[model samples]
Target: MLGTLAAVPVGERPELLAEPVAKAVAGLPGILVAEIDPELADTAAFCEAYASPPEFSANCVVVSGKREGQVRFAACLVLATTRADVNGVVKRRLDVRKASFAPMDLAVELTGMEYGGITPLGLPADWPLLVAPEVAAAEAVVIGSGIRGSKLAVPGALLAGLPGAEVVENLAR
Candidate 1:
């Protein structure tokens, strides 16, 4: 059941939030987009409110780094139970001097996704998407729908179908 919002027919929904995901799903073969109640944009708060142990929610983390003097960003999706090892794995993988969480404003501007709703679906093709294997193992996961007022339940495989998503083990700690 779709939750309350100005509902747009499946074909007419805005591309900003759900459309990219829809397109990604189309290529993946067989995944359905189930809608869920939107929560406050804060990951911690969302986990506390909906997650079983209040800490099992997986958040899409955006990290920024400079490689060869050119700035780049990578997104890592990890469970709230553990933090994305941005300073460890991400920095090493990107071969950068330093890596830090992108500021919310910058994240929003670059990704065209709200602070809390940044899914990898519509991210820039060149941006690397490192997904924790644990997350990919789950049947379905709840994630932001590119808007603050909605959420989406999508299969793990669908997530991997995004342009540059790579399933990595122990991406988080």
Candidate 2:
């Protein structure tokens, strides 16, 4: 059990996951799912209510920047204790003059996820998924399930291995 949450294999509770998340996790090993109060889905409240530590919770942030005229986007995974460095590392990585968190409406529409519960698992295949070294090396980490009512627990290596995923150093600060 992670904190007081009784996590079980994600496949065992498909109803708890968003449609895209349910599809993304199919056949993915070492993934667990647990239900939670929607109102506590934010990192701080979720951690406090579930007795999970910030270091063990990963936050998925969507960042976007325009180069020339085309907008480029990426999803970054960082431990809750630190925030993604959107202005520095992310900007440089995306090769854009400026980078910022994507607007909530855009993020939700593009990712097909709720505002507070976007996860990297089911993001558009074209978007790069950035995984912080610290997060990618953890034994297991908690992440959103594409909806506020549930969360997913999985080995960090699983995230690193996802398609288009890159392990970035100093991604968080």
Task: Indicate which candidate wins on TM-score.
Answer: 2
lDDT of 1 by residue, 44-110 (tens): 6554544434233467988999987899899998866778889889998778999999999999888
Residue ranges of candidate 2 with Cα displaced over 4 Å: none
lDDT of 2 by residue, 23-137 (tens): 8999999999999999999999999998988889999999999999999999999999999999999999999999999999999999998989999888999999999999899
Deviation in Å, model 2, residue 64 alpha carbon: 0.3
Model 2 root mean square deviation, Cα atoms? 0.8
Model 1 pairs whose backbones collide: none
lDDT value, candidate 1, whole model: 0.68
- lDDT (Cα atoms) of all candidates against the true structure: 0.68, 0.93
Q: Which ten residues in a row have the lowest lDDT in candidate 1?
A: 1-10
